[model samples]
Target: MDMKFKRNFCIVAHIDHGKSTLSDRLIQKSNIIDERKMKNQILDNMDIERERGITIKSQAVTIPYHAKDGNDYELNFVDTPGHVDFSYEVSRAIASCEGALLLIDASQGVESQTVSNMYMALEQDLTIVPVINKIDLPSADIPAVREQITNELGLDDSQTQLVSAKTGEGVDGLLEAVVNYFPAPQGDVDAPAQALIFDCHYDPYRGVVVHVRVKNGRIKTGGIIRMMSSGIDYKVEQIGIFKIDYEPTGCLEAGDVGYIIAGIKTVSDVRVGDTITNADNPAAEPLAGFKEVKPVVYSSIYPMDSNDYEELKSSLEKLKLNDASLVYEKDNSIALGNGFRCGFLGLLHLEIIQERLERDYDQAIIFTAPSVRYRVHLTDGSETFVDNPAEYPQGRIQSAEEPYIKASIITPATYLGSLMELCKMKRGEQTNMTYLDEKRVELTYEMPLAEVLFDFYDKLKSFSRGYASFDYEVIGYRPTQLVKVDILLNSKPVDALSFLSFKDNATDRARKVCERLKDEISRQQFKVAIQGAIGGQIIARETVSAVRKDVLAKCYGGDITRKRKLLEKQKEGKKRMKMFGDVELPQSAFLAVLKDNEAD
Candidate 1:
């Protein structure tokens, strides 16, 4: 294929705004797959993605289109995830493209993530084509969406394409617009081979299959490729582009997007955002790779069985190969044994990773309560950041700070008051507010990241009746009154149950955990005391009553003294048992405490 006819673009939009559906339409229009086998979100291959109706990973496909101008073209576009947590995936997709299809729902108009993704595409200097999707809906407001494209996004309205991805209306015109509007990828095919490693996945048979976008020259089978970051070389076993599935092309030239399979066994050898070049004749310099992603939420992942520690470690390494944003390190706990401290973009990202591990890797795992990284200044004139409560500074006389995020929420005006009240309950401080129109409002707030980690998103959806769209970015840490709350079962501290909380909410949080533990812990021979404590001071406590024997029932209508004596003996036995008995903490108890604000 000629470089002039190769077009690289990505489909970007807010969550549920028809990015994946639009991709499906384009794929169908190109006849890439048989019509009998076609399905919704065809690019989303993961089970979790289809079940949840969300694209967790960015999927790329090559569409062979014959333009009306009688020129054959190869169009490569990435269908990106729209959630704020998966913004990193979108950025990676944008970096590999020369343009983007900024899809906006006609009914919903413009939302928060829609604007965020536009700015990201603009930052990369990619050409954007404004696409209005879902025009077939009864509530579709094409004029209002066009107005937003002009006024809100600052994009020219004349170039906008109105199409319903569901009904496949006006799709051919959009396909023509893609070839005519977007610029062709430019690179010198004669230059040394240099490809950017945007993504990769581990294969049991082929080892690591590296997904790359060739910036210059070409990559061929049997060529030795070197990772610019790690400087490790491997023999390229195969090279091909994705046509729904991998189709080996034997060689990938400049401006091409495809996968290169190298017989590399170790997962750490290949790094996302690293440049791949011919080892025999490498490029003079590596391409300016992607910016490092910093995770805001941190939690520990432990296996159900201690013997699965090694398997868990292997699974994480393999999972990291696919999800570059996942950050993790070896972690240990007294109660849970060996595990890994993992960092994720948000609660949703954390959940997806847990599910992928269980479903894809067949690993049963337990995740501790999520926590945001906190900055702690110790009394010894030292500064430390703590994401794990177990590593919190023991004596912290100096001030402490917790991570804060600037949240942007777009909702209907009808739910503004309740949404504002919800933010206030989360200890959010209003930063800005704007009315997008008479019906829609955008609210901005600065709030602690920890407060938003648990139920804030769920509450935002419920309060707005699923009309609100929320997006946030972590700002710098702010001064906060922080305290470490520990859970003790029968006087023994469970390190896995410890967490850091705002001082004002520490007592309430501790009481909630104690109560949850009480319900989860079953009755024992002796009373089991579950206590939430700060240092030596106990903030909250709940007692699980002891299971008693029917000594009195056996006595029947015996003498009163006999019954009294038996009762006294039972009391003495209980006292002795309480001194030596160890309360068995079930996995359910830990899980119960991890759940946030569930009904008792």
Candidate 2:
């Protein structure tokens, strides 16, 4: 196979913009998968992905297409997740490709994620073939969408392709454009083996399978390869490309996109975005743009049952291999028992991981409310990071800084005022606002990450009537009046229910949390007092009345004096219960703050 005949490209789009569907059509047209067996989102093999109609993982496949120009081309298509939470996955996938298929919905036009991904592709210096999909829909306004793409992405009219991925309309022309416009992979074949690992996952039998794009030389079976990042060596057990599933190929050469099986036992050794080179003739320098990903949100995940702790640890380790972005540490809460503090890129990332742990690993988990990492500066001129509110320092004298983000929202002009007000309430400072045209606008704001972490997105959707799309990037930390508000039940602090909040909003936040907990927690035999306090001073309080049952029900037919005596004994028992009884908080009580706080 000649390098000139190979083309590597990735598909970038907003969620449900038809990237996966378009890829399926390409595979069908290329005959990579049997036409009769072709299905929508064929690249999304996971049952969860298929059911949700979203691509959760970055997947890749190779197709051999005989173009009308009388030449056979090997096309490598890297399919990426479209959600903002998985933007890192998209970026890593793009780093392995030479071109990108920028897909947009004909009806929705350009979205926030579409703009974000397009800029990312431009940053990678990849040739982009702009595309508009779903033209078959009745709501399709091709001209309007084309104008949006041109106005927002700055792409010329001639560079765009219109197609319907569902019905295969204009797909042939798009494929022709892909082969004609995209450049062939370029590298020296004689150079030492230097492959960039874009993705990897733990295979129970194979140990670890790494997805790589051969940059300079060739990799073959039975050869020694070393990871440049970790300085670990492994014997190449097999090399292959995705043809519906893994099909072992003896060797993968320069410009080739495929997988390497090295029987790797340790997950930490095979890091994604690492360079792999021949151990005998190692490359002097690794590929550029390799950096560790920092988590944006943190949460505590405990098993529903304490007996599943060991199994839960094993499940997390296994899940971590597939998702390197997941970071965890040993965490224990007095109210919730032992658990692991987990970090994620966003709420969706957290949800996907939790879902996978429960469904795939069959481990029921109790998830605490999500939080952002806070940087605390003390009076002693020292600094520390805080992720769990339970671990917040008792005396924070100097200042407290929290992570801030640069957020972008693309929407229609009708909701601009409401959106602006909403952002202001979230302590947002206006950064930039550009009008795409007379009808649509793109607004940018600098807001605290914690404000956006919770109900922001849901509220944005509600306010904009589902027309607004949002994307955000961390913009470092900013100092604020932050305080850790603790929830106490009967004067005993519940670690799982604690949270860091602004001092101005702390009282109101504590009040809501106590109210929510009151509804979630069951009543006890003794009066249960729910108090929210900052340090020793109480800020808010709610009390649940003791369960009062008729102790004299059994003595209904007895004399009045006998009933009075029974009541006296029952009253004494209640007092004893109040003195020694412990309130058993349900798992739901720990997460009550995250719910029923739309206005927060």
Candidate 3:
């Protein structure tokens, strides 16, 4: 393929703004897949993505389009995730492309994430094509969305493409516009081979399937390739492009996006942002790959069965190959046994990983309560960071700080007051408020990441009646009154159930955990005491009463002294049982503490 006729771009949009749908339409129009075999969200191969109606990973495809200018063009585009949690994926997609289709819902207009994604594309200096999607909807306001594109996004309205991805209306024109509007990918085909690894997945039989965007030179079948970061060499077994399914091309030249199979067995040998270059004629410097992804939320994952620890480890390694943002290290808990302390971009990211492990990897896992990293200053004038409750410093005497984020939320003007109140309740400080238009408003707040780690997003949606959109960026840490709240069952602290909470809400949080545990734990032969405590002070307590055995039932006609003696013996036996008996904490009990009490 000629480099001048090749166009590499990606679709960037907010969640539910029709990126995947638009990709499906392009694929259908390109005639890549047979009509009978085509499906909705064809680019999203993961079952979780289909079930959740969201794209978790970025997918690339090659579209062969014959433009109106009497020229054949090869359009390669990546369909990226819109959720704030997967912004890293979007960044990688943007890096691999020279242009971006910024899709906006016609009815929703400009949203928080929409603006965020546009800025991301702008940062990469990509040619952005503003796209107003869902124009076929009865509620679609094309003119209003056009105004947003001009005023809010500072994009020319005349350049915006209005289309309905669902109805496939004006899609042909959109494809033509992509060819004419976006510039051709620029790279030296004769230079040393340097392909940026945007993604990869493990195939049991073929080994690691590395997704690459060739920047310079060409990669041929059965050629030696080396990972710039790891300095490991492998033989490229095959090269192919994605047309929903892998289509072998034998060779991939510069300015192309495709996959490479090198029979690489180790998961860690290939990294998502590493550069792949020809070993025989290597590039002097690796391509500027990608920024390191930092995880804002942390949790401990343990196998339900202790023996599945190795399985869990292998699953995580394989999962990490696909999800580079997920970071984990060996972690263990006294109550939960062996586990891994994993870091995620957000709560949704955490949930997705948990689900993928269970569904794709067939590993049953337990996740502890999610937490944000906290900076602790000890009395000895030393500093340390804590993400896991068990690792919280016991002798902290000086001060502590928690990570904070600048949150941007867009919603209808009518819900501004309620959303503001919600943020206030979360200990958020109003940073800025702007009226995007007469009907919609954008609110910015500075709040602790720990506050949003739980049900903040859920509450925001509920408070706005699902009209709100949110995006956030970490804004460093602020001094806070932090306390480690521990949940104790029968006077024994469960390390997995411990969590850090703000001092003001620690009592309420502790009380909720105790109440939740009370409902989850079954009645035992002896009284089970569930207590939430900080240091020596007990903040909240719940007691699960013992299941009584009626000793007096057998003495209905007995004398009062005999009945009294039987009752006294029963009381004595109960005391002994309380002293020796153990309170078994069910899996549900651990999950119960993880749930937000107020979210109900």
Each candidate's TM vs. the true structure?
0.98, 0.95, 0.98
lDDT of 2 by residue, 450-548 (tens): 888778998899999999999999999999898888889999988888888878889988898999888888989888999999999999999998889
For candidate 1, what is the lDDT? 0.92
Candidate 3 runs further than 4 Å off? 556-562, 595-600
The stretch of ten residues in a row with the least summed lDDT in candidate 2 is 590-599
**Candidate 2 structure, TM-score to reference:** 0.95
Cα shift from native, residue 326, model 1 (Å): 0.8
Model 1 stretches with alpha carbons more than 4 Å out: 554-562, 596-600
Regions more than 4 Å wrong, model 2: 549-570, 591-600
Highest lDDT, which number?
Answer: 1
- Model 1 Cα shift for residue 172 (angstroms): 0.8
lDDT of 1 by residue, 1-600 (tens): 999999999999999999989999999998989999999989999999999999999988998999999999999989999999999999999999999999999998899999999999999999999999999999999998898899888998989998999999989999899898999998999999999988888889989988899999999999999998888898999999999989999999999999999899999998889999999999999999889999999999999899999999999999999999999999999999999999999889998998999999999888898888999988889898999999988775598999999999999999999999999999999999999888989999999999998888888999999989999988899999999999998888999999899998999989999988888888999888889999999999999998999889887686899999999999999999999888878887777677654221
Can you list the residue pairs that collide in candidate 3?
none
Q: What are the C-alpha RMSDs, in order, of all predicted structures?
A: 1.4, 2.4, 1.3
